[model samples]
Target: MTYSLQTKSIQCPYCGEQIEVIVDCSVNNQEYVEDCSVCCKPIIFSVASFQGEVVSIEAHTEDE
Candidate 1:
């Protein structure tokens, strides 16, 4: 079944800036890194979802 999920607003670990990220749980668990909009530094995000509800969120920097 296809499902639509609301995007989440997260803070960039490097610059502490706000950003919007869309999460799709219907596909599966996901992990990726994106640049901070304000600082241009890389921020890693790890998300887990089950039954269309966010189960866990882990955000960290490369040095962390």
Candidate 2:
């Protein structure tokens, strides 16, 4: 089975630009680095989900 999870839009802490972040794990828990749509800087994203709902979200710089 598959389910679409909720998403939240958050501004980049570095550049203060808005970006859409999807926190879905319908396939599996995922971790990756995606660039800001405005500043183009990389943001490390860690997401966890359970029972089709997001359990946790962590975003930070890779250098940290």
Candidate 3:
């Protein structure tokens, strides 16, 4: 079996700057924290996927 991930562009929740991120399609659900490239703020990443496809993605601030 072969798994292929996806690259997506999203705006930072703090600075509103667009950034590119890789999404793992193998994971049905994923949550991680990453720093915003522009603002350097912690961004809580929430991803949901189904059938090796991304269904939804959300970026939130650390305090939210």
Candidate 4:
């Protein structure tokens, strides 16, 4: 089986700027931190997937 990565645009909670993130569909669950392209603030990313499909993507700040 092969897995394909996906891209999504989300708003930054700190700066309210639109940013793009890549998601790996092969993993069932993943969590990581990435800096905002616009604000340079660390953003926590949470991704949930099942059967090579994405269930949800959540973005949060350091405080939350």
Candidate 5:
């Protein structure tokens, strides 16, 4: 499988800061974690993609 990287801007659920995230477009649907750039808190990511394109994305805090 090819690794396709897609960049997305999302608001941090914790600090409400806009952050850029790199998504793996090769995956159809994926859930992952990443730290916030501003707050350094763990972020939960829900990503949806199809055929190397991102359909939708959602960001949440660790508890949410």
Candidate 6:
């Protein structure tokens, strides 16, 4: 099986900066934490993908 990845832009809840991230579209539902590229703060990610594309995504601060 081939793993699929998609690049997405998100707003950091901590710093309000636009961050770019890679999302794995092979999974249906995913929850993870990634640091903001600009602020270097931990951010929570909730992602959902359908048919090899990301259907939904949510980015949150570490405390939120």
Clashing pairs in 1: none
Which digits, one per residue and each the tens of the lDDT, describe model 1 over residues 22-64? 7777655888887777787888889888878777777789998
Q: Tens digits of per-residue lDDT for model 5 on 1-64?
A: 5799989999999999999999999989999999999999999999999989999999987787
Greater-lDDT candidate between 1 and 4: 4
**Local accuracy of candidate 6 as per-residue lDDT tens digits, 12-58:** 99989887899999999999999898989899999999988999999
Q: Give the CA lDDT, 0 to 100, for residue 38 in model 4.
A: 96
List the lowest-lDDT window of 10 residues for candidate 1.
20-29
What lDDT would each prediction earn against the true structure? 0.79, 0.78, 0.90, 0.90, 0.93, 0.92
> Among all windows of ten consecutive residues in candidate 3, which has the lowest summed lDDT?
1-10
Residue pairs with backbone atoms closer than 3 Å in model 4 (clashes): none
RMSD of each: 1.9, 2.0, 1.4, 1.4, 0.8, 0.7
> Model 1 compared with the native: what TM-score?
0.75
Deviating ranges (above 4 Å) for candidate 2:
1-3
Candidate 1, residue 18: CA error in Å?
Answer: 2.0
Provide the clashing-pair count of each candidate structure. 0, 0, 0, 0, 0, 0
Give each model a TM-score.
Answer: 0.75, 0.74, 0.87, 0.87, 0.94, 0.94
Q: State the TM-score for model 6.
A: 0.94
Error of 1 at 25 (Å): 1.5
For model 5 the local lDDT of residue 29 reads 92
lDDT of 1: 0.79
In model 6, what lDDT does residue 41 have?
A: 88
Worst 10-residue lDDT window, candidate 5: 55-64
**Residue-level lDDT tens digits of model 3 in 1-64:** 6685998899998998999889888889999998887888899999999998899999998889
* Residue pairs that clash (backbone atoms under 3 angstroms), model 5: none
| Candidate 6 residue pairs in clash (backbone atoms < 3 Å) | none
> In model 2, where is the ten-residue run with the lowest total lDDT?
21-30
Deviation from native of the Cα of residue 24 in model 6, angstroms: 0.4
